[model samples]
Target: MISRKIILTFPQALLDKPIVYKLIKDYNLIFNILQAKITPDEEGIMILEIKGASRDYNAGISYLKNLGIDIRPLDQKIIWNERKCTHCGLCVDICPTQALSFKRPQMKIEFDKRKCIACELCLRICPVKAIEIQQ
Candidate 1:
């Protein structure tokens, strides 16, 4: 598996749209939205992790750039908030490959980002929208 990570800058307007989801589906590639940061100027910085063959990686990048995401590679840490997470277990159930899980006593969910296919099911199922995919 060839893995590539990219930091993208985009207009704030795109944030309101599910462009990332669309890109993932169109390319049939795997990705994880690590972080999303909003600037004072209303621009968005997104960190994304993608995995696939080399050709697929380049193709995915080209597709994203075509859609207007400024792509580059950088090192960054992504954080997930467990407090706002409802523990409804929607994310755990949605993982097709069982990449995420909920601990019984701790009542916390764990995400194995590498195992994620970037299906966006977790993001969609979180009723509170507590999970933020940052760049």
Candidate 2:
């Protein structure tokens, strides 16, 4: 039972209609939404806790990546700075796994380590390059 936390980033526009239920229905994995919030620029961010066999966990990540979702290991220590972010919402919009929410008026963001599959989208999309994956 090597459980781990995964962080996922998604577009805030999706929050107008959350796809989390669909993900649960499609993936058929037991998941809990630890944190959820939207950014002022309309980005949806969330943190998830996933538990299961290592094989199953990897399989789930593969499935999500195949679907074009952004997945990343949560063990990494990441820090966000508002000054660097341009509010372009690229990270929020491209997230396929619905792990990120930036739709809040304050542009608040949350991360769910369990749900992440380690796709590494945030690492690639962040313009200011604020997100980092630790381990």
What would the TM-scores of all predictions be?
0.51, 0.47
The true-versus-predicted C-alpha distance at residue 99 of model 2, in Å, is 20
The deviation in Å at residue 54 for candidate 1 is 2.0
Cα displacement (angstroms), candidate 1, residue 36, comes to 1.0
Model 1, span 1-135: residue lDDT tens: 687777788887787887777666766678887766665457777777888777777777887788788776754333447788777787676555455788778877886666654434456567888665576
Give candidate 1's whole-model lDDT.
0.69
Candidate 1, residue 82: lDDT: 72
lDDT of each: 0.69, 0.61
The worst-scoring run of ten residues by lDDT in candidate 1 lies at 72-81
Model 2 regions more than 4 Å off:
12-19, 22-28, 78-135
Candidate 1: where are CA atoms >4 Å away?
A: 75-135
Best candidate per lDDT, number? 1
